[model samples]
Target chain A: DTAVSQTPKYLVTQMGNDKSIKCEQNLGHDTMYWYKQDSKKFLKIMFSYNNKELIINETVPNRFSPKSPDKAHLNLHINSLELGDSAVYFCASSQDLDGADTQYFGPGTRLTVL
Target chain B: DQQVKQNSPSLSVQEGRISILNCDYTNSMFDYFLWYKKYPAEGPTFLISISSIKDKNEDGRFTVFLNKSAKHLSLHIVPSQPGDSAVYFCAASGFFQGAQKLVFGQGTRLTINP
Candidate 1:
C-alpha cells in the first residue's frame, strides 16, 4: 500500500482558475510537507505542517495556500493558478519534525496550468 | 540561492559496478544530509541519510559519505542493479526544526547498464 497518496495524480487547469490538490498519509506521521518540482527537476519545499499547524512556508506566492484539516491530511489550494504553477507538486510526511527520521512521500500530483 | 547542488546531471554505471553520485552544499550550518531516489512520475523515496556528527552511513548496497570540511556529500551504490537506475536527490537541513525544511540538489539521473 502507498504510505502517502495524492488525489488526481494529474491535474490540468486553465489560468486564473482556482483548484486544490489533496494529500493523505497512512503512516500516522505528525508532520507533512508540500514540495514543488519545476521543469528543471529542482525540488523545493513550499510548506511544512506539524499537528495541523504551519511550520515552514517558503517565500511562495500568496496565491498558494495549504490547509490541514487533521494530522493525516494536507491539501494544497492554489488561487488564480498561473502558468508558472505548471509543475509537479509532491506531498510528503515524516514521523517527527526531526532531522533523523525518514520522510515518506506520496506519488505526486502533476499540476499543469495552461 | 541554491544551497545543495548535484554537479553531475547524470551518471551511468554497469551492472554489478559502483555508482558514485556527488553533491555539494554552500551552507555552513547544514548538519543533516539525506539521499532520495525517484522514478519518473513518482515522488521521491528516502534511501538513506547522515548527520553532521557522522561521516558515513550505509544501508545494504547504498552508502552515504559526508565531508564537512569540503562541504560535500555523496551517495554510493555498490553492485548497481538496473532497478537502481533513477533520479537521485541530495538534501540538507541544519540543527533546526527536524530538517523540516530541506534544500535539495538539482538531482542526478543514474542509468545502470546490464
Candidate 2:
C-alpha cells in the first residue's frame, strides 16, 4: 500500500495558466509539507502544516499557495504559473512537527509550464 | 544562503565495493541529520539518521558518520549493489523561526556498476 500519494503525476501547461496538485497520506501523520525540486536537483521546502495549521512558510513566491484540509491531505495551487515553475513537487508527512522525524514523501507531481 | 551542502555531484562504485557520500553544513544549531535516497520517478526515501549528540549510527549495510566539530557527515554503504544506485541527499534539522525545519543538500548521484 502506498503511504503517501499524489495526483497529476505529469502536468504540461502553457505559461500563465493556473494548476493545482493534490496529495494524501495514509500514514495518519500530524505534519504535512510541500517541497519543490528544481532542475539542478535542489529540494527546497515551500510550506509545512501541522494539524491543519500553517507552521512553516518559506521564501516562496506569492503565486504558490498550500492548503491542508486535514492531517491526511495537503494540496498546492499555483497561480499564473511561469516557466520557472516547471519542476517536480513533492508532498511529505511526518509523525509530528519535529523535523528530526522521518518524513515520508509522495511519488511527486511533475509540473511543466511551457 | 544554503545551509546544507554536498560537494560531489556524482559518484561511481562497483558492485561489492563500498560507496561513500559526503555532506557539509554551515549551521551549528543543527542537532539532527538524515540521509535520503531517491530513484528516478520516485520520491526520496529515508535511509538513515544521526543525532548531533552521537558520532555514528549504523544499520544493516548502511552506516552514517557525523563529525560535529567540522560540521561534516558521511554515508557509507558496504558491498554496494546495483539496486543501491540512486540520488543521495543530506538533510539537517534545526530550530528556525521558532520551528524545526529540514534543510536539504544539492544531492549526489550514486551509481553502482555491476
Candidate 3:
C-alpha cells in the first residue's frame, strides 16, 4: 500500500498564478510535513503540522501556506507563484514528533513556474 | 548555514563490492541521524539510522556508523547490488522552533555496476 500519496505529479503554470498540491497518508501518522527541493537538490522543510496544529514553520515566504484539515491530510497552496518557485515539492509523514521516528515521503510534485 | 552535508555528489561501486557514503554535520544538537534512498521519479525511502548514543547500527548488509566527536556519519553497504543504485540522502534530526525537525543534505547519487 502507498503510505504517502501526492496529487498532480507535475504542475506547470504561468507567473503570478496560484496552485495547490494535495497530500494524504494512510500510515496513521500524527505529523505531516511539507518540503521543497530546489534546483540545487537541497531539500528543506517548509512547514509541519501535528494533529492538525501548526508546529514548525520555516523562514518561508508568506505566499506559501500549508493547511491540515485532519491528521491524514496536508495541503500546500502557493499564491502569486514566481519563477523561483520552480522546484519539486514533497510531502512526508511520521508517527509522532520524536526525532528518531522515520518519515515516509510522497512521490513529489514538480512545479514549473513559467 | 547547511547543518547536514554530503560532500560527494556521486559514487560508483562494482556489484558485489562494498559502497561507503559519508556525511557530516555542523550542528551538535542533532541527536539522531538517518539515511534515505531515492530512485528516479520516486520518493526517498528509509534505509538505516543511528543515534548519538550509539557508535554503530547494523541492519542486514547495511550498517551506519556515527562519530559524535567529529559530527560525522557513514553508511556502508556490503555486496551492493544493481538495485542499490540510487540517490542517498543524509538527514539530521533536532529541535527547531520547539518542534523536532529534520535537515537533509543535497544527496549523493550511487551507481552500482555489474
Candidate 4:
C-alpha cells in the first residue's frame, strides 16, 4: 500500500484564489509535515504537526495554514495564493521527531498560480 | 543564505560504476544527516542517514560518510545502475527535532547511463 498520498496532484489556479491540498498516510506515523520545493529545486520546511498539534512553523506567510484533523491526515490551505506560491508542495510523515526516524513522503502536489 | 549546499547540480555516471555525491553545510549544531532520492513529479524518499556519534554508515550498496570537523558529508553508490537515475537531496537536522528543523540542500541530479 502507498504509505503517503496527496490529492490534486496538479493544481492550476489564478492569483488571489483560495486552494487546499489534502494529504493522507496509513503508515501509522505520529508526525506529518509540509514542504515547499521552489523552482530552483530547493525544498524548505513550511510546517510540521505531531499527533494533530502544530509543532514547527517556519517563516511562512500567514496566508498559508496547515490543519491536521488526525494523525493520518494533514491538509494545507492557502487563503490568497500568489504567483510566488507556484511550486511543488510535498507531504511527509515520520514515526517521531527523533533523528533515527526517517520520513515517508507522498508523490507531491504541483500548484501553479497564474 | 543557504545553510546546506550541494555544489554540483548534476552528475553523470555509467552503469556498474561508482557514483559519489557530495554535500556541505554551514551549521555546526547539525547532528543528524540524511539523503533522499526523488524522481520527476514525485516527493523525495528517505534513502539513508548518519548520526554525529558515528562517522560512517552503510546499507547494501549505499554508504554515507560524515566529517564533523569540516561540516561535510558524502553518499557513495557502488555498481550504479540505470534504475538509479534520479535527484538526490541532502538534509541535516539540529536541535531536538521537536525544538528545531531540518535543513535541505537544493539537490543533485544523477544520470546513470547504461
Candidate 5:
C-alpha cells in the first residue's frame, strides 16, 4: 500500500500563476511537512503541520501557504509563482512530532515555472 | 548556511562490493540522523537511521555510523547490487518551535555497476 501520495506528479506554469499541490498519507501520522528541492538538489523544509495545526514555517515567502484539512492531508498553494520556484516539492509524514520518528515521503511534484 | 553536507556528488561501486557514503553536520543540537535513498521519478525511501547516543546502527545490508563529537555520519552497504544505485540523502533531525524538523543534504548519487 502507498503510505504517502501526492497528486500531479508534474506541474508547469507561467510566472504570476497560482498553483496547488495535494498530499495525503495513510500511515495515521500526526505530523506532516512540505519540502522543496531546488536545482542545486538542496532539500529544505518549508512548512510543517501537527494535528492540522501550523508548527514550523521555515522563512518561506508569503506567497506560499500550506493548509491541512485534517491529520491525513496537507496541501500547498503558491501564489504569484516565480521562475525561482521551479523545483521538486515533496510531502512527508511521521508518526508524531517526536524528533526520532521516521518520516515517509511522497513521490514529489516537479513544479516548473516558465 | 548549509547544516548537512555530503561532499561527494556521486560514487561508483562494483556489484558484490561494499559502498560507503559519508555525511557531515554543523549543528550540535541535532540528536537524530537518517539516510534515505531516491531513484529518478520517485520519492526518497528511508534506508537507515542512528541516534546521537549510539555510535552505529545496522539493518541487514545497510549500516549507519554516527560520531557526535565530529558531527559526522556514514552509511555502509555490503554486497552492493545494481538495484542499489540511486541518490542518497542524509538528514538531521531536531526540535524547533515545538516541532520536529529535518535538514537534508544535497544528495549523492550512487551507481552500482554489474
Candidate 6:
C-alpha cells in the first residue's frame, strides 16, 4: 500500500484560478505537513497540523491555506494563484511532532500557474 | 536568510565510490538533523538522521555525521550505485513558536555515474 498519496499529481492552472490538492497518509501518523519546493530546489515548510490542530504556519501568503480534516488527511488550497505559486507541493506525515521523528512524504504535486 | 545551507549544488561520483554531501546550519538550537533523497517527479524520502548528542549514525550503506561545535553535518553513501543518483536534502528541526518545525536546505544533486 502507498504510505502516502496525493491527488492531481500534475496541476496546471492560470493566474487568478483557485485549486485544491488532496493528501492522504496510510501510515497512521498524527502530524501532517505541507512543503513547497521551488525551481531552485529549495524546500520550505508551508504549514503543519498535528491531530487536526494547526501547529506550524510559515510566513506564506494568505492566498495559500491548509486544511486537515483528520489525522490521516491534509489538503492545500490556493486562491488567486500567482506565477510565484508555480512549484511542487509536497505532503508529509510523521508519527508526531517530535523533532527526531522521521517524516514520510507522498509523491509531490507539481503546480504550474501561468 | 537560509539557516541551513548546502554550498555544493551538484556532485558527481563514480559508481562503487563514496559519495559525501555536506550541510551547514546557523541555528544553534537545532537538535535533530535528517537527510532526505528525492528522485525526479517524486517527493523526498527520509534517508538517515542523527541527533545533536550523537556524532555519527549509520544504516547499511548510508551514514550521517554531525559536528555540533561547527554546526555541520554530512551524509556518506559508500559503494554508491547508479540508482542512488538523486537530489539529497538536509533538514533540521528545533523548537519554534511552541512547536518543532523542519527547515530544509537547498538540495544537492548527486549523480552516480555507472
All DockQ scores: 0.72, 0.85, 0.96, 0.76, 0.87, 0.91
Task: Judge candidate 2 at residue A52 and give its lDDT.
Answer: 94
Q: What would the per-residue lDDT of candidate 2 be over residues A13-107, giving only the tens digit for each residue?
A: 99999999999999989999999999988899999999999988898999998988889999999999999999999999999987679999998
Residue by residue across B16-102, what tens digits does model 1's lDDT show?
999999999998888689999999888899999999999999999999999999999999999899999999999997654434568
Candidate 5 lDDT tens digits, B1-114: 999999999999999999999999999989899999999999999989898999999999999999898889999999899999999999999876676789999999999999
The interface root-mean-square deviations, each candidate in sequence, come to 1.7, 0.8, 0.5, 1.2, 0.8, 0.8
Model 5, residue A14: what's the lDDT? 97
lDDT for model 5 comes to 0.95
The per-residue C-alpha lDDT of model 1 at residue B1 equals 82
Quote the lDDT for A56 in model 2. 89
lDDT of 1 at A90: 92
lDDT of 2 by residue, B34-91 (tens): 9999999999999999999999999999999999989999999998999999999999
Worst ten in a row by lDDT for model 2 chain A: A97-106
All models: lDDT?
A: 0.92, 0.95, 0.96, 0.93, 0.95, 0.94
Task: Give the 10-residue window scoring lowest on summed lDDT in candidate 2 chain B.
Answer: B94-103
Q: Please write out the lDDT profile of model 3 over residues B5-67, one tens digit for every residue.
A: 999999999999999999999999998999999999999999999989999999999999999
Q: Compute each candidate's TM-score over C-alphas.
A: 0.96, 0.98, 0.99, 0.97, 0.98, 0.97
lDDT of 1: 0.92
Better structure of 1 and 5 per lDDT: 5
lDDT of the structure predicted as candidate 4 = 0.93
Give a tens-digit lDDT track for model 1, residues A1-114. Answer: 789999989999999999999999999999999999999889888999999999888889989999999999999999999999999989999998887778888889999988
Give me the runs in candidate 4 sitting further than 4 Å from their true place. B96-98
Which residue pairs in candidate 1 have backbone atoms (N, alpha carbon, C) closer than 3 angstroms, thus clashing?
A: A98-B98
| Candidates ranked by DockQ | 3, 6, 5, 2, 4, 1
Off by over 4 Å in 6: none
Q: Considering summed lDDT, which 10 consecutive residues are worst modelled in model 1 chain A?
A: A96-105
> For candidate 4, lDDT tens digit of each residue in B43-68?
89999999988999999999999999
Quote the positional error of residue A12 for candidate 6 in Å: 0.7
Q: What are the per-model C-alpha RMSD values against the true structure?
A: 1.4, 0.8, 0.6, 1.2, 0.9, 0.9
Range of the 10 consecutive residues with the lowest summed lDDT in candidate 4 chain A: A96-105
DockQ-based class of model 2: high
